[model samples]
Target: MIAKLTDIEALEAKGFDAAYPQKSPWDILRHQAETRPDKVAIRYLVDASDPARDEVVTYGDFARRIMGAAKLFRGLGVTPNASVAILAQHTPSAQTAIWGAQIAGRACPINPMLKPDHIAGLLDAANAKVAVIMGVNGELDYWSALVPALREAGVTIPLLACDADAQSPGADGVFEEMIQTASGKDVQPEGDETALAAFYHTGGTTGAPKLVQHMRLNEAHVARSCAIMHDLTERDVVVNGFPLFHVAGAFVYGLSTLSAGGTLIVPGRLGMRNAAFMGSIWQQVERYGVTILGVVPTILASLKATPIDADISSLRWLLTGGSPLPTELADAVEKHTSVPVRNILGMTECAGAIAVEPVHGTRTPMSCGLRMPFSEVAVFGETEGDADPSKPLGPDETGIIALRGPNVAAGYSDPARNIGTFLDGGWLVSGDLGMIDNEGRLFVTGRKKDVIIRGAHNIDPQMIEDALLAHPDVLTAAAVGMPDAYAGELPVVFAEMRQGSQAGEAELIDFLRDRIEDPVALPKRIGTVDEMPLTPVGKIFKPTLRAEAIRWAVGQAAEALGVEAEIAVDEKLSTRVMVPGESVDAMKDRLAGMPIKLSVEARS
Candidate 1:
């Protein structure tokens, strides 16, 4: 086994292909099955309420199941060029579908929480031959609602149900039954390093979804790199609650653990969404002797209130990503659990990893740690004349972060979407704004689009968020640009206070006055929410806040004109306000100076 990654340069010197010989995920699993067949590969909880109610799959059984899934898909007419779309929770069968589909064809795991039309769009985009959906299981009945919706959306592909119950209907076959009966003796992996392994949709709230094509080499390299970064081995047991559709679940936490022959314990069907599971997460860790705990920032934030009820000495590292890790939040988690929190920088285009804080390394204040082995991460100028990748900015110069490595995906499925991002020389231009420090650690500042433009000044919302998060009573904070008629846009903050903290918005605003450096960056207003809106993957949902900000701005503008305006924000976030014809001129005048385009309709 490769030594723990203390120095990235040393790992790169050994050469990526030479150090990690496993070319595909199947290769890794096959090696484990051959060497240690009886070792537990997966421990899936049947019910999150009771940790003891679980199912186990050994390495040998998992390998055979993967092969069986491949054979079953082949029997269903799946080809390497075609895809098997999966709309299910994280179950053993779902895991089988992911790996098996990859071996037989391509795996396309869709977010089951998405609307039917969106899911159908992804299916069409992937060129899917068959779909594996989660069957009815009590309150978790995605099969009951989704199957009909998919059919209504004109999805005619053959559907299979995983963990199907008697109440579940409309699927052509059962995933587990077919896999168990299929012959796995002669089935083999069909793809190679360059072959497409999966299609992961980018989580854009609007527009047509872009499917990132992960090559077999991309998955292999990332999984191996993550295993090395975390010092993962057969002894380690990771508890990964991330959904299958997300790269963090499949590659960062799921495959990385498997690649090292470690056991992966997945929470029940609801995964991290299961409130009962989250409440008893520490107990579950102790029950399973979980070593590596993977979570997003939102989950980390929520853990602050959850009392550690059991001995969690088994946990070595707490990994967080999918959003920026607030330094305060990291500090809080570390203090509470006595476990180091390692921040990760990843994206779907890179098969989940770009940079990961080494478990053995000292934690940097806000750094996402070193780049992946044999990968180049540089900060390029974002300006028009200086945006060339060849002219990367010097240390500490913040700009567009770009990556080039074997782990980077082979561009998006729609080639047109690759124009600005997938550039020449194998570089994937990440839209994120970041800086590589002198020590080679990466610090993501914010996204290019996330910058709030207040006339000529470009303000990063993170600066405001970081400032507000420093407050003791604030549990979560988000900064957004509130529409302003005079300044084009002004900074505003929304914060969720810790439980039992009576601190109000005015008190938080007063707290930020001294913390924020820039006068322009200081929030124009502060609002407190009982609970902050979060994405399924646990990132702060900024779009929802932005919509709320827009409504607040319209309300203020209409109030100035002495008119009641009804506001409507479409899926695209285009804001339209309607008022009486008499007040149209005054309302338009009030909102004229704002940069945001507003449709002011004069009601008859």
Candidate 2:
């Protein structure tokens, strides 16, 4: 029988998996290698140099590579429980490194896009002894300049480079080259299920990001639960484009596919410039007979805009998460693709997904669906004069959504962030606001945290706000999310300029571009406000600012289209523009290129 969230107890529960002893993620690979050595395990689609060729890795070869990397780790003096940080763009080699790190030591997948300072802070927090970084590529060279930057920040960890030049300093040979030469006989993992396996960094409410710790046991448990949820089998072909650093890329989608002995397909990183890859996604799905696909809302939007002519009858379901999926977009996808669209809800703290729309199940618009087996969810709220904010709220009452189960991370790396984030009963206090119906289905309303979900990446607006405040012309600044049709949300800033100083939107945007390494965090528009809404205690009233930002985005969109419409913005910032005597398709066509996303409806 498949395990349910209620069947599992706390992390400290004795003999937690006594009925079914957990297996290491490496063991899952070994079992598949032995059982189906010739079976194709991974296929890399859309090679930039050769678009026609796809690199395939069989189960046996995948296991051997992991074993070889394990031996290489042992040779480098990495012991069990040691932390190894990997910083590289999404690639087959990067995924191989993750498996190798877990077999020998703890794997910490650092975001490749982070600036050197942020990278240093993460490496320091993980206490990584060795860092594997991208080599001297044309772009995204994590080794060439990042090594010196990390060193300057007092991080003296040994460096391993992927595709590094032979003469590069601090490079202990190439990763692919060393792994091939190493013997695969001495691979030994001593950790049990509960032993720490990986450290994933996620944006916290604070200025600094928090390190989420997951155990091998958590991976095993989550994988099994997910396998059953998706009805995964050996015949299933799963495709994913999320980076391996993210939980879905590593555990929920990746490990779960392995757990069911299914073939996992890793496409190249998702970007607009890679039009060659993005445009041919449907053809790739047909070529591989892709049974299951995972995508963010932005990808769906792109696919809708550029229709691909390919037979997708083999596709069983298209799973979407990471950001809010619009009801209209979902309907459009289903109508075009003729595949069941399942919207899932998950977080890094929750290993991967805790809830998903069941196969052939009915769905409520914008609802994240029922909680999966073995995962417990509750709505926690506060009552007037109640000392405990952790009190469980009644059904249908909007409150903070708290989760508990084997899937949840053990705890955060920082003790300070751990406070109040975890309740007395081990329930993780998700910064999201939601409500559960009497039927136990969850409806996510909004986020209490100030972070914005920009496509696949979780952007911390405070990072940008802090940078804007340092500018001489900026007196006060607040960054918030503005609704977008393509990207779920775009970062927008509202700033009150100094009385005598002058700063325009373009100039401030240039200032932010120079300071912030991540362009996603940069504000799309900067509105000069007379005064920001402030609470009685002098804190910026962000809710009011967020509402204003959404309205402003809608107004701009309407003015650009030259359409007089009545617009209504929901709590999630989903806009509905009603234009008298205008057809939905025509209105949509007119507002196609607008920054804000609005659904065009005709008023009777």
Candidate 3:
């Protein structure tokens, strides 16, 4: 289903147009306005002192404003194909900016909350033609301050201000100016399939950012995937507080909802820490009957913690992704809000979620469901070297995941990325260790690079992390595979306690005894930490944590097990065992002192 040059036009006709009437994300929005002009497209929840009052946006009005913003950009000489960067919180304006960019030419969605260094890096990397800065609260921090920094880092893009809150002094007229231009513009894109759409960035585990170049045709395919995956229709309404920068924010939920003719609900920000802000989202859900809600596990976890539970009955389903959902968090979220929650799994390299659990799932369930349409999946045998698909493993056989499909990103911003993930054959290495069951469900087992080997038995860090988080008192946990001289690699778990609650390491060890099927799978060291290290997206940052824990253990993990005074020979085989994480060289050095004889038969 790779959109080949030969079949692209045909595929475009059969796949995209059949599913959606409007050509592009922007066009679909405009079409929604024309067909259902007065329909509500977006409802913005504005936080108030009491946490009940909020704002709203009708589809017809949303379209008019988007057009106005596009016109404003046009008046500012924001020509077609010029990259426009959006630096703002997840809100109606952010969505408007993205649509405006589509109408204007090109849009580069950026995380406004990104660290200054990363922000500068991405700006320079994109060589953005212009930047539209939206206020991050009252700080009024505009993109103007970033101009000099971007120049230093190799970017000279001009910066403009978006109305809400901008910090720059004496800048050009705000986004309103662009909106005025879009209103008056007598010309529009002809829904051209050849038009370049947007660029998305992905940096999962590889620790290096890679850009995903999407053409208009690819976006249309992504829209179709979203439409089907979410079960979206004209009657549906979504509260899209998810960041526009993340895949879940744009491709997974946002643009898909629009193409489906469903209304959108946005908030000033998705920051749940501010009860007032979060309450606004709940208000929209209740007042406007926001049926669809998409968010990350971390955000959902925080929302579950909020005590005030007003009416959220309008929310029929809540979608969570970006990281594995801890079972405890999932259960708590269900208890707090009656909405159904499903875990979605995929990456930016892929347009959106390739696998997601059903919407009506009861309680938190395992396994992201059957592969979506146009997805090719294979689980290669988990081995030490280059992955081989010919020797693919069976159900429950943990291995690297390789996928090829229409929605997969064409290539990274850096062509060199293809060397590791994509071969000449066209498959994309997911870089994740996963398995497909006979039922065709996919279970992601941590990063392939994070596999923990203890003794001869290989361990999955994700498995132990799952067990640790299952503890009632535990809030979040991360298990890092550390070097051990005897067994090869042993796992050290760093965990955090729930707020205002304390649980000892002994309790954790006992909990593991009840949860884990294999005795050896229990964590060797349960280290209590204030919190687990996490990336911006909340996935465990174990490389640095693993290094820190090894130092604290003081070589205990590296020590060999001392022999008992009288070693009894067992007639039966000791199937359940603890072998040391020993390298070949270290194993030989330790074996030199033992009386055990090396046998060719055993070695073979």
Query: Could you give candidate 3's per-residue lDDT for residues 1-604 as a string of tens digits?
Result: 3112223234445764465555567777777888888776765656534335555667788887877767665665566656577877667777787777777776778755444455666665554667776633463353555545555665555566664543455344466555555546543754476466677765421124456766665566666666665678888887666667776777777778877778766655543334555655576466667788777664675567556445876678888766555454566677778767777776666666566664633332446655555556778864445567667788989888887766666676678866667645557777777888765668775466565544323355666778778788888888765544234345678888888766788878888765653455678788877867777887776755665544433234225534111111222211111233334334333322111112111111
User: What TM value does model 3 have?
Assistant: 0.67
Quality of model 2 by C-alpha lDDT: 0.75
Model 3 ranges with Cα > 4 A deviation? 1-17, 20-23, 48-55, 68-81, 115-121, 136-155, 165-167, 182-187, 190-195, 204-209, 270-273, 279-284, 360-364, 382-384, 389-391, 449-604
Of the candidates shown, which would achieve the greatest TM-score relative to the real structure? Answer: 2
**TM-score of every model?**
0.75, 0.89, 0.67
**What is the C-alpha lDDT profile of model 2 across 17-91, one tens digit per residue?**
542244668878888899999998887764634646777888899888888888887778767757788987666
| Pairs of residues at least 3 apart in sequence or in different chains that clash in candidate 1 | none
Q: Score residue 116 of candidate 3 by CA lDDT.
A: 48
Kindly give the stretch of ten consecutive residues in candidate 3 with the minimal lDDT sum.
593-602
Q: In model 2, where is the ten-residue run with the lowest total lDDT?
A: 3-12
Q: Report, for every candidate in turn, its global Cα lDDT versus the true structure.
A: 0.82, 0.75, 0.61
Identify the superior model by lDDT, candidate 1 or candidate 3. Answer: 1
Number of the top-ranking candidate, with lDDT as the measure: 1
After superposition, the stretches of candidate 1 with alpha carbons farther than 4 Å from their true spots are 1-6, 205-207, 383-386, 449-604
